[model samples]
Target: MELKVSSRSHGDHTIVTIVGEIDLYTAPRLQSEFTRILDESTTTLMVIDMSGVEFCDSTGMNVLLSAHKRLRERGGVLEMAGPRPAVRKILQVTGLDSVFTIHEAVPEELLAAEPQA
Candidate 1:
């Protein structure tokens, strides 16, 4: 399936939502999106919404890892949210689940407004 990627800002975070399969053919698109977000945005936290991802191969995984590494090098953070069962299993098997802060969903606290003093 074709890959779709979109990004938006939420508070101090930038959320990138990705849908469809991610294989060797489609990984480049995702990588490009990540590169664009990292280069264009100054947000310290980047959360990848993987709920719509149906499949991911090693190339795709590498792209994610590279993005995580880049963010870390810049003193930023890379997180993942709502990965499907199959993709979750890949992360677990590859030990990436531990490398990234995995969220069941984009954390509500990030989306919530700060209480006025």
Candidate 2:
């Protein structure tokens, strides 16, 4: 399946919604989106909405790790929300569940808040 990536700003956070499979062919697209968001947005917090992702491979995981590292280096945070069972298992097996702040869902407060000026 084709990978789809999009983002929206909410308060101090940027919520990136991703769908479809993330693998060798799709990971670059995800990486491109992350690079764009990092370079353009001023927000220090990013929430990755992973509820739509049905499959994610090692390349996809690496892309996520790279984004997380980059965010941390700039004193920002990268959060994962609503990962499906398979992705969640991969994270757990890889020990990345401990590294990332995984959420059951994107926080309601963040979605309801007005974007920061």
Candidate 3:
């Protein structure tokens, strides 16, 4: 499936909404999207909206980790929102649920209002 990425920033936070299947074939596209968002301006918090994700694989998980790593390198952070149950389970089983900050697809204003960890 095709994944469409949309991005916007509020203050120092940039949020990217991901809609569609995320697999090896589309992970590169996600990476490119992130690059573009990062290029738009300086930021320290990145939020990924996963409410529309239909399917995912280990490759998709790797993409998530890469995003986290990318933000960390800049003393920043990446948080995922509303991951589907299947993907959520995958992340949990891989012990990554604890790695990526998660929330219900809320706005950045209220997102940080409640920290997952």
Query: Over the full model, what C-alpha lDDT does candidate 2 score relative to the true structure?
Result: 0.94
Model 2 per-residue lDDT tens digits across residues 1-117: 999999998656899999999999999999999999999878799999999999999999999999999989999999999999999999999999999999999988888784656
| All-Cα superposition RMSD per candidate | 3.3, 2.2, 4.9
Q: How far off is residue 83 in model 1, in Å? A: 0.7
> How many backbone clashes does every candidate have?
0, 0, 0
Question: Please, what is the whole-model Cα lDDT of each candidate in the order they appear?
Answer: 0.91, 0.94, 0.84
**Per-residue lDDT of 1-117 in model 3, one digit per residue for the tens?**
898988877678877888999999999998888877776768798888898998888988888888789889989999989999988888888999899888977565745644465
- In TM-score terms, candidate 2 sits at 0.95
Pick out the ten consecutive residues of candidate 3 with the lowest summed lDDT. 106-115
Checking candidate 2 for backbone clashes, the offending pairs are none
- TM-scores of all predicted structures: 0.92, 0.95, 0.87
For model 2, what is the error of residue 70's alpha carbon versus the real structure, in angstroms, after optimal superposition? 0.7
The top-ranked prediction according to TM-score is 2
Which of 1 and 2 is the better model by lDDT?
A: 2
Clashing pairs in 1: none
TM-score of model 3 vs. true structure:
0.87
Error of 3 at 63 (Å): 1.5
